[model samples]
Target chain A: AQSVTQPDARVTVSEGASLQLRCKYSYSATPYLFWYVQYPRQGLQLLLKYYSGDPVVQGVNSFEAEFSKSNSSFHLQKASVHWSDSAVYFCALSMTNSAGNKLTFGIGTRVLVRP
Target chain B: AQTIHQWPVAEIKAVGSPLSLGCTIKGKSSPNLYWYWQATGGTLQQLFYSITVGQVESVVQLNLSASRPKDDQFILSTEKLLLSHSGFYLCAWAGDSGNTLYFGEGSRLIVV
Candidate 1:
């Protein structure tokens, strides 16, 4: 079966500091990868996605994710953090096969930015 | 642009009561619809998906059911609610040939 893993349950970062959220996935074949962000009381919003080509993809809010087939990882990164950037982040994976397409999400990582 | 809407932004009901939630999509036709549930601190779990009207597929068994009576509408309901059903319910739709899902505002359900 396929699954997503977000090792860090919670991360605390200072404002204006660089941010990185780690993600690992388990799948037999190349998988469709994605990064989503959820604000309090709000539904998730897509940050970036990787289907094929381009190891790095840029997304909204100055967020970017790098897809590493070798490491089986798709980590989200940002040059500088902002107060409003504090939220829950999720990593997802999908493989389009005979069963159609559906997403399997990771446990998610909550990031808190102080000052 | 495409938009998804979920009704009854929030609901509070007894454990054994009945429940119904609705979702509608606009600016897209024949889109793939899906129902996702999130526990208070858990990740998103797919409950059901519908590729076309009157055809719904279950992805998880949580004592809940979903239906797609119209191309743009999807409904999630349960004859008897359980306390474990309390959480956030999100509705999403994907474009044709693309697996990228767009989520709605979401509905918060509290079953006491």
Candidate 2:
């Protein structure tokens, strides 16, 4: 079974500060990695995804994630985060061979940007 | 542009009451539909998926059932709601088996 782990349960940062959210996955095959953001009372929206090629994938709102095969990590990074960036971030992984193509997601990390 | 919509944006029903949530996808045809449940701060758990109308697969059963009556409509319902069902329910549509899922705004349920 594929699983995802997000170490940080909560992260606090000041506005304009750089941010990094750690994510690790365990899968038998090369999994499809994704980063999703959920605002308060809203469903999650995709931030970025990596299928093949290009270790770094850029997403909406200047979000980017780097996929490392050896480390089994796909960490989301932002050069400068704004106050509006405060939300819950989830890292998900999907295996191609799985039934229903279900996505295993991390517990999520709540980001709070202090203005 | 494709859009997904879920009905009853927020609901507060007494425990043991019946429940039903609906999702509709527009600007797309014959898309794969899915139902997912999320606890207060937990990861999402897929409940069901439908490849076509009238055919649904249960990924994980939580005493709930899902039906895809139309090519673009999915419904999640239960005869009796439980206190454990108090959380968020999201509807998603995937282009393929399960690639990128476009999610609806979601429906929040509170079984008090």
Candidate 3:
């Protein structure tokens, strides 16, 4: 069984400030990691994903994440956050042979961006 | 382009009443479908999943069931609604080993 852990429950940043949300996973095989964001009254949207190759992956809204196998971490980062970036972010892990392609997700980090 | 659709954006049901939620996937064949529940101010929970037609797998059985009657349609149902069942229900579909899942608008259920 695989699981994900998000160390931070809430992360606050001021406008134009850099931000990073930490995520760690526990899986036997090479895990597929993803970051998703959810705004108020909206569904979860894909932020970025890391399968293999490059340790760092870029996503929309100037968001990026770096995967470290040694540390088993995939942390989402942004150079500068805006007030509109306030939302809940989730870290998920998926495996190829898993039944039904079920994904294990972290509890999520609620981000608050102040202007 | 692939998309998933879930009906009844918001529904209110009484305790002990029957409940049903529908989901449909487009632009893909034999895709993997999933039903997820999110409690108020809580994390997401996997409820059910369907890989192929008529093959449904239960993840968290909370007095609820899921069925895939057709290739593009999936249904979530329960015999009786409970206050605990009141939450946000999301429908998602994935292909190619669930690399990325596409989500629907989500259905909000309020058990009164």
Candidate 4:
């Protein structure tokens, strides 16, 4: 079974600071990885996804993620974060061979940006 | 231009009462629909999925049943509601098998 692990439960940073949320996956095959963000009382929105190709993929709102096959990691990074960027982030993985395409998600990391 | 809609943004129900929730997908054909549950400020747990009309797969089976009557409509029903069933329910769909999913706004249920 494919699984995702997000190590940080909560992260706080000042505005204009760079941000990185760690994510690790356990899967034998090359998995489809994704980053999603959810605001308070709102549905989750996709930030980006990585299937295969270049390790780094850009997403909406100036977010990017790098997929490291060797370490089985897909970490989300942003060069600069704003106060509006504060939200819960989730890393998810799905096996390519799995027909259902069910996504296994991490526990999530809550980000708070101080002004 | 795919979009998913879930009705009744929030619902409050009593234990033992019957319940029904509806979801509809737009701008897609024969999409793979899914139902998920999430606790307050928690992770999403897959409850059910439907690959096509009239077929539904139960993943959690938390005293609930799902049906897909049309190509774009998925409905979740329960004979009797439980206090434990109170949570946020989300509807999602993928353009095809093993494709990326899009989520709905979600329906918040509070069972008392």
Candidate 5:
């Protein structure tokens, strides 16, 4: 079974400061990775996804993620965060062979941007 | 553009009461539909998925059942609601690539 682990449960960063959320996955083979953001009482929105080549993938709102096959990790990064960036970010994994492309998500990291 | 909508926005019901939730997808046909459950401040767990109408597969047993009677509709229901079932229910559709999933606004349930 594929599982995602987000080490940080909560993160507090000052506005305009950089932020990084760590994510690690456990899978026998490389799986499709994704980053999603959820605001309060709202559904998740895809931030970005990693498929094949290019270790670094860019996403919306100046967000980016680096896929490291050797480390089994895909970490999300933002050089400067706005107060609106505060939300719960989830790291998800989807196996190519899984039925329906079921996604296994991390517990999510709640980000609070201090204004 | 494709859009997914989940009904009733939010609901509150007593324990052991019957419950039903509906989802509709517009502008897309024969799209894969999925039902996901999320506990308060927890990760999402896939409950059921349907590749086409009249065929539904259960990924986990949460005392719940899902069905797809129409090509663009998916339903989730249970005979008796449990307090543990109180959470956010999300309806999603897989993109053509089958790699990305687009989620609806979600339905929130509170079982007292």
Candidate 6:
């Protein structure tokens, strides 16, 4: 079984400040990693995903995440944040298989970007 | 472009009431359909997924049932509603690659 853990439950950052969300995964082999953002009362939007290739992957709205196989972690980062960036971000893991591509998600980190 | 729509944007039902939710995918044929449940202030749990019509697979049973009636339609239902079922229900679809999933706006359920 695979699982994801997000260490931060909530984070508060001022506008124009850098932000980072931590995520750790437990999987025997390399797993597909993703970052998704959910706005208030809205469905989740895919931020970025990583399988192999480059260690760092860029996503929509200037978001990016790095996959570290050695540490079994995939952390999301942004150079700067805006008030509109306030939302709940989730880290998810999916293994390549034939069985419907099920995803296991982390508890999510609620980010509050202050103006 | 592919689009997924979930019906009954929001619904309020009493406990023990029968409930049904619908999802339809447009511009995509034979896409993998999925149902996910999210509790208030919590992560998402995949309830069911269907690769083709009449072949639905359960991921985590929440006393709910799902069915793919058509190539583009997926339905989630339960005979009786529970307070635990009060949350957000998201409908998603994956293309042939099946690497990434696209989600719908979601429906909010409030069970009293």
Q: What residue runs in model 4 are displaced by over 4 Å at the alpha carbon?
A: none
Query: What's the lDDT for residue B21 in model 2?
Result: 100
Find the 10 residues in a row with the least total lDDT in model 1 chain A: A94-103
- Estimate the overall C-alpha local distance difference test score of candidate 2: 0.92
Can you tell me which runs of candidate 3 are displaced by over 4 Å? none
Query: What DockQ do the predictions score, one after another?
Result: 0.78, 0.76, 0.73, 0.72, 0.94, 0.90
Q: Which residue pairs in candidate 1 have backbone atoms (N, alpha carbon, C) closer than 3 angstroms, thus clashing? A: none
lDDT of 3 by residue, A12-50 (tens): 999999999999999988888999999987788989998
User: Higher TM-score: candidate 1 or 3?
Assistant: 1
- TM-score attained by model 3: 0.96
Q: Calculate the i-RMS of every candidate, to one decimal place.
A: 1.1, 1.0, 1.2, 1.0, 0.5, 0.5
Model 4 steric clash pairs: none
The worst-scoring run of ten residues by lDDT in candidate 4 chain A lies at A94-103
Regions of candidate 1 where Cα sits further than 4 Å from its true position: A98-100
Compose the digit string of candidate 1's lDDT tens values, residues A27-95: 999888999999999999999999889999999999999999999999999999999999999999988
Residue A83, candidate 6: Cα error in Å is 0.7
DockQ class, candidate 1? medium
Q: Evaluate residue B19 in candidate 2 and report its C-alpha lDDT on the 0 to 100 scale.
A: 95
Q: What TM-score does chain B of candidate 6 reach?
A: 0.97
Better of 4 and 6 by TM-score: 6
Tens-digit lDDT track for model 6 on B32-57? 99999999999999999999999999
TM-score, second chain, candidate 3 = 0.96
Per-residue C-alpha lDDT of model 4 across residues A45-90, encoded as one tens digit per residue = 9999999899999999999999999999999999999999999999
TM-score against truth, every candidate: 0.98, 0.98, 0.96, 0.97, 0.99, 0.98
Per-residue lDDT over A47-72 for candidate 2, one digit per residue giving the tens place of the 0 to 100 score:
99998999999999999999999999
Best by TM-score: 5
In candidate 4, residue A59 scores what lDDT?
Answer: 98
Model 1 chain B scores worst on lDDT over the 10 consecutive residues at B93-102
lDDT of 2 at B3: 92
Q: List the residue pairs that clash in candidate 3.
A: none
Q: Please identify model 5 stretches exceeding 4 Å from their true place.
A: none
C-alpha lDDT score of every prediction, in listed order: 0.93, 0.92, 0.91, 0.91, 0.96, 0.95
